[model samples]
Target: MKWLGVLLAVAVAVIVIYKVNYPSYSYRYRLQVSIAVDEKIYTGSSVIEVVWDCGPKIAGLGRCAPSLGGPATLIDLGAHGVIVATLRSGENISPTPDGAIDAVWLCASAFGYRSTNEELPALPHLTGRRNLSVSNLPRLVWFVNPADMKSAQKVTFLNVASVFDPTAHFTEAFVEITRDPIVVDIPNKLPWFSELRRLQKEGKGTLSKSGQFQLVYNMFVGENS
Candidate 1:
């Protein structure tokens, strides 16, 4: 009888904490990242947990957590383009108020279309395995949805090259979707690598150098209860 009472109390506490702390709506996004370098391909994956925050339903909504600095980074939710969240990366890099996300996606697209009408070299491409012709960067747009809490999401520096500085190297990239995040180790010859090797041997793909490529893919699992 005593043990049953204790179990019930603990269960109630857990529910309360989750309700208060976790976002009203949340989803787990699994991202598989990979790259093509020097005719070889290497890959890895990261899990992005996202939360949405819906501020007061009013026009010209005021900023959240002003003392923390300025307004949190905001992105447009896909459907209505509803603005959401003060975005931050898993590394705690706070999102900038500027439209950096849009800019990065833009630059990630076609290159050499200049403001001055001069010909320039094109930018590297981010391809989708299922749809290779167009850039796969749009897959990342889901992050803009608002959540009450921040997701532990990570986007590698290489992909962020468009928005961030120190631009260098041309690389072909793709994302292989997954239900959950995977830990890819190079030395152990994991299952993922086995497939990579098979692809390479069959002339379907190239082997990636260690730490050369980052694989990221995502699936929208059901919302939090």
Candidate 2:
């Protein structure tokens, strides 16, 4: 019995060692979107890349990645009359003609923030920060529940149309700032939050009942939306 117990302990230790030594590989990601506008469905994909300051290694991991340099089009609300779009990370089911990263990079390049490349490029100057000037409420944070591909999430953008300010400047003069996506929360604080609820109640605004979802709000003070 003593010998058997020792063998079991040894086996367990070996398993633990093997599991700990195994490394997790990270890959660049791509996003696909399926937009539902009334009866018409439109689709596109975009390659999303994070510029790591260093290669994948413990010494390099401490380096920070840049945020998006400016407001880029994630989707064209006007061109396709996009109402609601389903976004997933891949190219299998939908095409990726309309990509957020592409738009951001292009605009960033035009402003001379970073030079563009044919393949996976890095925007070294872009850094992520919460812009309090845009909204007092923090942006939405999310992760999957049950960790299954089948689970889907629904989010609404309050005053999605009004978030963007037309006249905004992008420069390397100050640190290039890229805004994160916002999600709505309770105890409505911003004036826009009240306006959104009032419009929803009054049956006004571009967003309609058919398009209603639990709203998510992220406001970049100068983003194009």
Candidate 3:
């Protein structure tokens, strides 16, 4: 009986040690987004590269790729398509298209004061934080329950109709500040996929509900929307 009690104590001690050490062994990531573009469902490995500096102390920092969840779009802004009975060529100069990153990136990019050395071809200064600012809050951060994709049926896109005062300035140095595609890989049975059904019925486009969601938000922020 004494031996049994000793063994039990040892087992309990081991369990306690494990419980205390588990967090140390695990990775504590910085970013997580329930929203992902490209209609991708969220999985364990979804990631997006983001900038992390606005001023000097925060200058040239790259945020770790973030984890993401489902149902967004891959926006090809210059995508050649038939629009309003015309072969419309997408805009070139002083132009901003519509779409979103994983929700976390969007929130940080718009709301968080940060930037990176990451530069795009057309807009090399895309990460310039000296003048970047988020003038308003959109639907990204509100009630972000992983299981609520249903109520989020329709997605919208808004373009910045005009290029005016920039919170930051991108040097016109052959940089392309194009938005990257937000991608996440999730299993078929993630939380809240039922929301997609309602999205399909109410979405603005037939392509996919998440696709519409990306576009609609981009449009709502038209030019800057």
- Compared with the true structure, all predictions reach lDDT values of 0.29, 0.29, 0.27
lDDT of 1 by residue, 28-139 (tens): 3333333333344444334333333333324554211101111122222233121211112111122422222212222222232221111111221222223222332322
* TM-score (all chains, Cα) for each model: 0.27, 0.23, 0.22
In candidate 2, what are the lDDT values of residues 142-197, reduced to their tens digit?
11221221222323233322322222111111112433332222212122434544
lDDT of 1 at 14: 92
lDDT of 3 by residue, 1-225 (tens): 999999999999998765443311101112222222233322121223332222222334322232222222221112111001000111122121332233323434442423222321112233422222233112221112333333323222122111211221211111112344433322132243234333444763322233333212222111110
Please name the candidate that would achieve the greatest TM-score relative to the true structure: 1
Worst 10 residues of 1 by lDDT: 216-225
| Better candidate by lDDT, 2 or 3 | 2
Cα deviation of 114, candidate 1, in Å: 28
Greater-lDDT candidate between 1 and 2: 2
